[model samples]
Target: MKKATIKDVAKEAGVSISTVSNALNNSPLVSEDTKNRIIQIAENIKYVPNMNGKMLKARKSMTVGVFSSSVSGHYFYILVDSVFKELRRRGFGLNIVINKDKRALLSNVLSKNFDGIIVFDNERVGEHEVELIVQNQIKTVFLDRDLNGADVSSVLFDSYKSGYDLTKYLIHLGHKRIYFIEGEENTYDNLERKRGYTTALKEIGVEIKEEYFFKGMFEESYAYNDVISRFRLGNSQIPDAIVAANDYSAIGCIKAFSRLGYRVPEDISVVGFDDIEVARYFTPTLTTVRNPIARQGIRAVEILMDMMNNDMPGVSEHLAGEIIYRDSAKAKVL
Candidate 1:
């Protein structure tokens, strides 16, 4: 004889799968009478919840899950490493899942595989999914976007202010004709950074030219090719300075300028955000905004632990950035 599943119990009780799940988890959304009916039906059918679900009910998984879109960059490496060390010190384990499929991501999240989750994939987990997670009472800390819920918190970098300040600094260095490189479209950090750049330009009475904007996709090679192609086309005028979305893209822009026989900060100044490990080691040494990557991870863990252990309400925290002046950029010679 085959064992009974939640779906089988739901069918027998004529209730939704979510209703069955809520009843089993003792969620308050279901009425007392409905909850009792579901429980009785589940018992009659011998329905058995998954082991992870059982752990969730008992609240003893002793682990956290990190859901990310991609974990290949230097930024993610530092963030995850910090989270790992912090969790280890507290006697907990870590699980990382990288998936682009929203359905699979949702399933993994709802599976209760971990006690709490730290989400970095804004594309996969949007407003609707977040609501479902909250309904299920999963403690979550979002790294890439800002959201507040009963059990959801956000830890974010102050991208807008940093971008504005960096651009203002460039303008102060006597740069007038400035070009901007963009990251992936519609991302929270990317959007905020772009907004700051444009705001700074407008405040200084500088015209924001659409032709000066180029897509770099936050990748070094993409930024390199974008720069090289623009220069090779000969249709666009060379700007006095260029601002890239991140350090990797900035380094790529530098390499492209070098290949075109243009000297960095001599022929054209350049700057980027996120002072990654390689920023200082690059030939010209990138000038950038230092994002608190490790601190973000550490603080995220602290907040999640508080929610999971102490039953604290979620809160939002914003980390600020610092300007790191380096050799890659300089004042324009009048």
Candidate 2:
């Protein structure tokens, strides 16, 4: 005789395949009488009770995956560290994968390995490019940038608020003309942070001239070269202060400023975001926003566990960042 199957149990119970599954899993929707009858029929049919089989029926694979665009950066290292820590604390081993190319990243996500995935990558990774993330029925949580219309969980730094706060700090110190150094144009945080800077300037009755805005790559060298090239071309008028998108870029600005015989916070005040480890130990410690880097990792695991266990509704969380005051910024004394 052929082995009994879910179909056999469903047929024996005179119900649909779904009804039999719900009965076997003890889902609250099933009536006590129906559940008891289904269990009796499953037993009589010699159906073996297996937890793995139940999980399979529920479309769960019992594993989690995390991705970063590239594993070469300091921020990526921080994010990976936090994610692993949290996942392990929750008793879930994590799979860390980096997709060097954007196209391949999408392809990897389309090819499912485990249950859910969390992403911490730059904005070059688009919402449409990640449509495969949703189509695969894989739960997602985006760490850094906000992907519009992609229905997924996110735990990101408050970029707009951080920018506004940082700019306000500079302005309050009597700096009027502030040079704004930005990240990639396609990045959401870059745009939001710029918006905050503009908003603060507008509120303080300061006019923002196009000459003071500079866009550079995420690398310190890129920002340093961009600033150096622009400064060398200038006719002696420079902004009184500078706001960098991140600590790496800020370090670049500092290096360029020093080479040009300009002192930070004395010749020009500077501020940065995502206060990475090196920010604190630098010559003139960086005044920047403390992004909840490690906390996001812990939270991702908590959310993933909830997702795996069906503990809560689809949750989206936003973590806040606090600005750390240090010697990099100073009030201009009359």
lDDT of each: 0.88, 0.76
Q: List the residue pairs that clash in candidate 2.
A: none
* TM-scores of all candidate predictions against the true structure: 0.83, 0.77
218-330 per-residue lDDT for model 1 (tens digits): 99999999999989766778899998999888998999988988999898999999899899999898899999999999999999988888888999899999999999999
RMSD to native for every prediction?
Answer: 8.7, 13.5
Residue-level error in angstroms, candidate 1, position 41: 27
Summed backbone clashes in each candidate are 0, 0
With candidate 1 superimposed using the best TM-score fit, by how many Å does residue 248's alpha carbon deviate from the native? 1.1
In terms of lDDT, the best-performing candidate is 1
lDDT string for model 2 (185-268, tens) is 767678878899999999988888888787666679989998898887666587788999888889999999898888987888
